[model samples]
Target: MEQIIERIDQLWQQFSGQAAADISKLPQSGSDRMYFRVKGAEDAVVNSAIATYNPHIKENETFLSFTESLKAAGAPVANVFAVNEEHDIYLQEDFGDRSLLNELEEKGFTADVFALFQQSLSKLAHLQIKGGENIDYSKCLTAREFGKQAILSDLLYFKYYFLDTLKFPYDKQALLDDFDALSTYLTHTENKHFMFRDFQSRNIMVKDGQVHFIDYQGGMLGALQYDVASMLWQARANLPEEWKNSLLEYYIGEVNKILPNPVDPVMFTIQYNGYVLIRLLQVLGAYGFRGFFQRKAQFLTSIPQALKNLSAFTGNRKMGIAVPEFDKCLQFCTSAEVMSRFEPLRADESTPLIVNIHSFSYKKGIPSDPTENGGGFVFDCRGIFNPGRFEEYKTQTGRDKAVKDFLEQRTAMPDFLNSVFDLVDISVAEYIRRGFASLQVNFGCTGGQHRSVYAADALARHLRNKFKVRVEVKHIEQEAKNWINP
Candidate 1:
């Protein structure tokens, strides 16, 4: 990987005629490709570019072709900068670290973020219509078009990856027949445009105070409905019903204005809803494959949210046609019997131990234990250097970056927490074996704004990760006012 970074930096220097200062590897996404943000020593050609190392030569070729087409059609997409001789390594314009999903998650559904959603939909219409005009189907990474076969593939993906993984019983032949029926109905729609196969908030980046798209390598000619369904019905985003409805209408209106002839809004919407069901099922299949089969904790954790979103659609599935077997599979997936496994473990009488954690100020003394069993550990954080002494972090709590950095870098907080974790682990394990219901661990500092709060939160995280026993945390000082995490 270090060698790859060196090679990438060398390539950037070769292309830009400027020495590369640093090449930092980015986080791994769903795809197998690795990425890095390459910074230039001198800004000759460009200051920063996203360096990609994908072994799939064909996929890389398709992405380059699509970007050129999307760029020509006024789509908000990054430009291809350079590609290596092997075609495996390439450089593209960096849209910065902030993606639309990052914005939605961090700031939530603010007015500005909502507008970005709308803006993305409006541009999507253009990407599908104008940007899609001259796209050579021959250059597509997979299927030439998202026709009956393609739609059926998505349904089958859900069936094999998600449904088959579970021990759910349903008529296989009948489900196939239903898949054929559904796929045929969807492909019969008049509209065919470039469909971003994985169009979600994460793929859409918010750069230069505008929305820019990434990871559209799997794009193909399909109805606009599928992409819209992918974004609005994203399990993680879990967009509000009102926003989904508004965004869909807005997208359709944009499409109508661009196209030579307007589509019937009523019919288009019905098809859109059908695609919503398809997209949801397809997503579940992906989660199951990545989570259950691959044993990825991140994907496994997301199963509940995906299941929750699927149930909302399946509960009132007005698809204008019924597939009893498919419906049965959907119902089984959303059933309480299956969902219970993903839910947090409850602390019942027979369930053994529950650890109650608290952070308080020395001024307030130790917090009182709620349970009848009152014996536990109370660690003093006053010995540790407090960031509260600094004026810059005076208003900030332990959760804030400045205070957290101060505590972590300047003080012996990490060593202190490591020792605390060792002590807590013993009692927690023994308590679980002995069927102990409660354990109270408190951290007290001068103000509870810096040291104690950080320590308590750290210990809570440690316990949650190390043990299956239920853990509860309380910041008495923060609760008295409110918490701050930034």
Candidate 2:
């Protein structure tokens, strides 16, 4: 890691003619590429850029070439500033920390967020049609085009990595025949467009309120519908059915404006549905390979969502192509029995831990243990200022607006919570990863009504918003009305 950091610094210096003021490593994604955020010297004209290092030279070359093509076609893509083919390190425009997926999570599915999705799809249509022009197919990482073989590869990816792993009953030879039929049916579509192989919300970054695309190293020439399908059918996005239909129409309309001739609505719908099925299955295979086989908990969390998508798709309508065995496989995969394997832990079911948080008066003793395990964390809040000592706030509990304001503005409660977050985050994260069943966190003070209550509520909100985990908050001294469950 030290050698890699030094090399990134060297690359930054070589590119900008001065050393970077700061170079920090970025988090790794599903890909093998290592990323870094490099800031130019304090006085330099270029302030910052994203540096990427991949061990594969050929893949880097393909990405560089594709990026240039997409940019030239007026797509919203980051520009490549420098390249070191020998070291397989390159620099590109930094799109910052926000992705469409992050935006959706922070600000739910609002009109403004949906507008961004519309703009992204409009730009995607342009990338598929205009970006394909004057591009060299020989530089592609896999097949030069998404042809019959490529379609089959995705179907088989679903079969071996996902279906077979489930131990579901199916006729192997019949499924293979169905796979060939499906591939043949899909490959006949208008496929000479630039296909962003893994185009999903996570790959679309929102910088300065505009969407910028990335992670197209696996892109190749393919049908236009495939990219659209990849985006709308993204497992975790969980886009509403109405939104999906409207977005599909919106994309088709954009394609009409870009293409010399418009597509037939009927034919387009048929092909689009076919691709959606293909993409959904392909992603389930990916989730299974990354989650079940590799034991990555993050990927495992997505399996249920993907299965839900498959269920919705298969239940609504049949694909135009006849593949009875394939349909049978889909039905089996989306069945209640198969899906239960990936379902979130129910109140009655065993697994995925729930955190129980309580606020209590130290004089009255700590909250009683509710789980089979006898011990848990108890944080003392006595070091913090007591808002209850003040006359105006004496009668009010932590949930009251005045008491909340006092704790936030006047006390060291924020600092105390930050320190507590630092400690508890480690355990909460590890517990979720290991599939532990329960965790109890308690905050105690002179009285339960003020400091302790405030701390418990704050921690519960933080855990739910950050980890999407179940947090139940209780104020022991308050009435039953003060209890919160989610």
Report lDDT per candidate.
0.84, 0.84
Candidate 1 regions exceeding 4 Å error are: 42-45, 346-486
Q: Write the per-residue lDDT of candidate 1 for residues 293-323, one digit (tens) a residue.
A: 6554446557888889888888864777777
Per-residue error (Å), model 2, residue 215? 0.8
- What's the lDDT of the predicted structure labeled candidate 1? 0.84
Please give the RMSD to the true structure for each candidate, in Å: 9.5, 11.1
**What is the C-alpha lDDT profile of model 2 across 1-486, one tens digit per residue?**
557778888888788988888887776675678888999866667789999989989999899888888899888899888887484899899999899999988898899989999999999999888988967778999889899999999999888888999898899999999999989888887546989999999999998789999998799889999999999999888899988999999998999998887998778888889999999989988888876676544566688889999899988855688889888888899999998776643322443678999988888898889688657689999998888898988878888776786676567887788778767777877787778778999999997888898899888887775567888777887744444332
User: Would you estimate the TM-scores of all the predictions?
Assistant: 0.74, 0.74
Stretches off by above 4 angstroms in model 2 are 85-87, 348-486
Q: What is the lDDT of residue 217 in candidate 2?
A: 76
Report the number of clashing residue pairs per model: 0, 0
